[model samples]
Target: MLTPDRIDSEASALTGAVRELARRTHFPVSFGGFVDGGNAHISAIHGSRTRSLDGLNVRVMRGLGGRVMAEIRPRATPDYGAARHITHDYDRHILGEGISTLLAVPVIVGGRVRGLLYGGAWASANVGEVVMKPAFQVADALATELRVRDEVERRLATLDGATAPASGALGPASPRAQGGAATPTEPHPSLPAAHREELRESYAELRTIAAAITDPDVRARLAHVEQRLAALSGDDDTAQLTSSVSLSPRETDVLACAAIGATNAQIAAQLSLREGTVKAYLSSAMAKLDASTRHAAVTKARRSGLLP
Candidate 1:
């Protein structure tokens, strides 16, 4: 279930994306919002001249943004009022802001339309690749973040219902409960095999998400969650093994992808690293774990509580 905090965070993310769109494309007006029910509520705006766009609720199939939402692709018009391809449901707001050219992009995630982003100018102008490219990039980045958050929330919900530490705490307490330290180990026996697999997948996804995030606070929060996941999958007997082993963040990321059976090339693409770089990281991780192969490295890392 979506909580108030989650909704606020989503809005903040959209607002930041809108600000970035305006900055990168130099659009005179940029705004966007998430779709709730059937309307795209315009909750974020930048560079707007007037209050005409405030509180605008764009309905699907009714206007350019709406059509973008319906089509799940970008749409633009050089002359908003004279454009014959789209309906005039939003002319009062669009024209009221003196916008002559408009571009709209859909925020698609998991093959579904999650939100809409828009950029516009007061003078009629062509919307070409130069403008579209950065707009698309911002939208895609936002979509990726949203997808990560969704996965994290879903997995956390499952974990909340699954077994927790005896102290009833689900965070750092789990690690200390094992042996007064933080370690990664084999999956807890009480958790079913399917749940353990799900936890591993979530941990891998979190690592990927952490790699792309630039905000220190967000990264810290994700790291905390990653630690909780690691603690939950630990084995009591191997809790002391982690003191002798330490893996860099990149090494751990590479191993997390490896844990999910991803090939070196796949890990490279996912981590935005060269294949050679991926190999080097893998080799180093294997050496540090004192393993002869990638598979053995992953196993040893898990047994030493270095991985979950």
Candidate 2:
């Protein structure tokens, strides 16, 4: 249930996680880097002496980390100076780290390489399963976290595209009338078909991410996002055009919580009410809005401008 800010905070925590992994696995040095365009930018480093690799850019397929990006998997080298397979473009930087073994694991999310997790050792040791296994696990967890972040970004974009227009625009106005005027077509009163489809796809992805989240608090946060998206997709003629939908204060409060995917128990705890009371309020709101489900009620409420 982390907000955008919290999600970012969690992503940044990968650096610390990398440091811990390096220490635990007998690798004295570790760093985390992210890919941007055609280059990898080193963002976090620990146990480096020269600082040469700090903030350095490794071109795609040109170095150890670069090869990882190209292959979209984990790679390692027992001797950086003697590795003949990878290009030696980063030899200077790698040598500067004073490590004999190096390992790089690509952070793949949603089918694209997003970043890298790296580990290195000061002694001459082979970077085998012992080192690579833990690094890969870290990379896998990071990929899921990155996927959540990616979904959040896409969700925001979808919302912006669907909501950015004249207030109550509701597609086109149709025409006029048939007398001597023009005939009016039915107004959409919701997002355009293309935009709606985009939102639906984004919503589905968010749900997938939510289901993948193991943290209860984080999962709840994602659930709330799903509810908001569901509310955005609700459409109605009376609610959109005339704004006749109405609910009591308690009803509105309960519906707002439900809109964010809050369960009845959670809503009760948040509102300091009994579970039965929360359910009663939700039922009243749904009845008033003529909605068959909690999600429908939220959508109807939002279309009527009753909730943001």
Candidate 3:
């Protein structure tokens, strides 16, 4: 389940994507929303002429946006009102907005439709690849952001559950203690072998997500989450070294991937950097830590509390 904050964040992401779609396609109107309770509620609207589309709920298989949600593909009509293939369920809202030509694209994540984006114009016009391509790109970017958020939330929930007090235990764990308060110098409780591995994986995934995100605010938030994951490793012995050895963000990201046994090419692909660039970052990190090899660099980073 998503918290109120997460729901608001998702809505903001959708709004940003929809605004970009309108600008990219040069459409007079653009709007979209994520699926909830089997309906795609129009929560974000751009360049609207009136309140006709405001708060509109589009049901699956019921209208143009609905059909796109159901089909999980891009669909459009040069003449929306005259198009007989789709039901007229949203005619009042859509036609009321004077949308004669419209295009709807699905935001698919993990092979499932998570949301829908629509671009429309008041005058009838053919929707070609030039417009469809950018619309699709915007939807794809939105899907990636949504997927990253879902993964981060799931891992955080798991972390919470793992650190909670077990039955018959006298007190909760120190990291996520009962009151959720811990001193800056307090050592994190050791995690199970499996949990530690999960934390490392989550850290690597967060780095990959940060690389692909275009929004600086979202990327910064992900970076904060990465730091939390790193601090949960219970490496208090390295507290002194952590302050002594500083690695740039990109260098740390490369080292994190390397710690997970990723090859240079694989790290390059994950971080969206060239293989040579990956090598340079790795070398720079190794030099900072005085390590001789990639494996040594990763080990030094782990001991320095630079990675989970």
Candidate 4:
């Protein structure tokens, strides 16, 4: 779960990513914003000659990033000073930064626009596909990071709520008392079994998304969540380190898909395999776990800390 410290870390990590994008793409300036209260809050900037854009709040469809967010697609202009398609709400900031051209990419998570990434050039120039590809890649990575953070925050909220006293009642057992660990608090012993199942499902979703993600940075962050989920599930350090629980890679992939409630056909379509192949893999996974049904297989995998 994301504490204040973890939030700071996420912000710092995102800032670094923005800076690296600017440096690698050879853009004179780069900036990024996260969606907050339906507004794009400028959170990270790099290579800016002026502070006009610092902490800018771009309303949806009011500026470049906002337009991208509203459209849920990348947009670019060779000449920001004369672009006729966009609202010029931030022209002053653009001119102040000496940027004549810019590109904006929407950061989408779960099919919703969650943030935006921007790259700027001082001279009027076309932001070609070569540059646009990397810009969109950065946006995708940021979107994944934001999703991971949100999941962490949700988990933390659950834990906090569970530990809170009810009408002056006492909290759950401490980490040291419950699991003999001084750090990395384990899941509360009194938490209901249903809630644990939910956590495992969330963990499995994270793993499936991580497996599908192509961005290295996003995958790394998701890996951390996987480890945390293992700990929360009472899986030991050795299991976390080994991680696979003797499941073959294909078996793991099949079970990961099943864990997310994907049908055999849907999984086949996703993995570009025949439905029979999907069924065979799932059957193999079930046999390996000695389970008789798909749900049972998922349950066994989660209990073994293999799905998450």
Candidate 5:
């Protein structure tokens, strides 16, 4: 079975995958990633679309790209003004890119518009099935990522957990999602690579101690800490959270610290963890947050109401 960690790692890979596809494909390819709202704001604008001439807050059902998302289908338009019904709304953004003919496809997942993938040309060229083929492939790859993340989440949820509405409807002591109390609740705006590396070391040293420690009092303390870190470490939200959210409690403490901008060495000194162990927790949390960057992960968490 795919572990939560694997699922998140794979979803992240798709971002690069989709981007590379646009760069390699001969068309003036661009991908505007999924925005939080119904209207698809440009998350990533590539090729010609990179040259922005308008503002954000693009409306659906306006231009070639907007229409594609509004209709939840693929569309090819030879002239922007020709689509008089929708042209006026998004003409500026598209025209600035020097687009005379364009194809826009939505990256649909679970009946929702995750993002949009586009291909266009400067002249009125007929972008037939041949031109459209690879575009669909790219969109498909991006859309499929959601399902993989969802599956990992399901598996992670099944491992002796608690279910709180992500909205923070419950109190702080409502208990951890996976049957524990010490886990902290909050989200990151983004999680950096250094944060991830910190958590990585934490999880490793923990395993080392779990197997060999023999003192009764120390063993009991370690056992409790392990369960908490396990719950914290193992959550899967590739589109939403990353390595996995299934972490043990102590691990959650580490994540909370990093979320607050704690350095690995600082976290180590504060929590009495070796700097290495703190790195492990940060890395593991980065995966659970499914955030490629520190800021993004933090945003995802706050938006989900994870960070209270």
Candidate 6:
């Protein structure tokens, strides 16, 4: 396994991502950290004060971390003590820090909880608005990155003595043409108007495959390709999108929750929406993006700046 330093670095990227997500939100720039048995603990104690801690225990399947590890789902507590079914085991430490609300979303990759990104509100019913929404965004990105990293590690685990057709990426393609200054090339040519439409469909599908990929290198490369195609083919500009692609506030909720790998049932629960209503929102977003699949719809919306 790679050192905790590498893992932490990968996880820390979520900080900037979350911060940006919450910038216009109701959150006032809170901080979060993932603690384990080893190394110094982060996710500093902050409510009225920010205190750094060392040597905090994060046992598997206990407290917020434990439940996330067990359920592999994002958990939210609007009023920690007031909420039912919550074990306030961490209340002494957390309440001392002046936290009133908490949200912990698990970073589950390959069917295991690698770590958690958690935060709380000292005094805000809007914690669900400012904190939880962005928390879900960060969690989704974390899930994507960790899942990709795990897949890369698994594929790399095989050696010359082993025989499996390398289940993931082929690694960096000829870096010179890409890494160096070079002119772009033309896409395949000589197709009818309908054929061009089909190519657009194909490109969208390729982008979905790229984002759906569970390997960081491959996903990154595929995203690059998708971006290039979107730029050249005029598919990426949100300004150029049909009005149908634009999502309303409620529809955005559906798409954002979906981005975090939330199922209809789970999204309905989280959004306090009916299951049928959730599906309706998803279907609407899909129609706006002209996507045949949920993944493609998400990739399109994300690329087009419709969803952060």
Strongest candidate by TM-score? 3
Off by over 4 Å in 2: 1-14, 165-208, 214-224, 230-308
Q: 164-283 in candidate 4: lDDT tens per residue? A: 435533335654233232233233334456665666676666665665666565566666655655455543332222223477756776787787688999877767678998899889
Using TM-score as the measure, name the better of candidate 1 and candidate 6.
1
Pairs with steric clashes in candidate 1 = 184-305, 185-305
Ranking by lDDT: 3, 1, 4, 2, 5, 6
lDDT for 294 in candidate 2 is: 93
Cα misplacement distance, residue 219 of candidate 5 (Å) = 32
| Candidate 3 lDDT score at position 12 | 90
TM-score of 5: 0.47
Each prediction's RMSD to truth:
3.6, 9.9, 2.8, 6.4, 17.7, 13.1
Of models 1 and 2, which has the larger lDDT? 1
Candidate 2: tens digits of C-alpha lDDT, residues 68-178: 888888888888889888999877778877878888888888777888888887677776676677777778877777667656756766676565556545335522111
lDDT of each: 0.84, 0.69, 0.84, 0.72, 0.56, 0.53
All candidates in order of TM-score, best leading: 3, 1, 4, 2, 5, 6
- TM-score for model 2? 0.61
| Alpha-carbon TM-score of each model against the true structure | 0.85, 0.61, 0.90, 0.64, 0.47, 0.45
Candidate 5 lDDT tens digits, 65-145? 677777888888777556565666666667767777777777888896767766667778776777677778777765655
The pairs that clash in candidate 4 are none
In candidate 6, where is summed lDDT lowest over 10 consecutive residues? 181-190
Error of 4 at 102 (Å): 1.0
How far out, in Å, is residue 38 in model 1? Answer: 0.4
Lowest lDDT 10-residue stretch of candidate 2: 176-185
Question: How many residue pairs clash in model 1?
Answer: 2
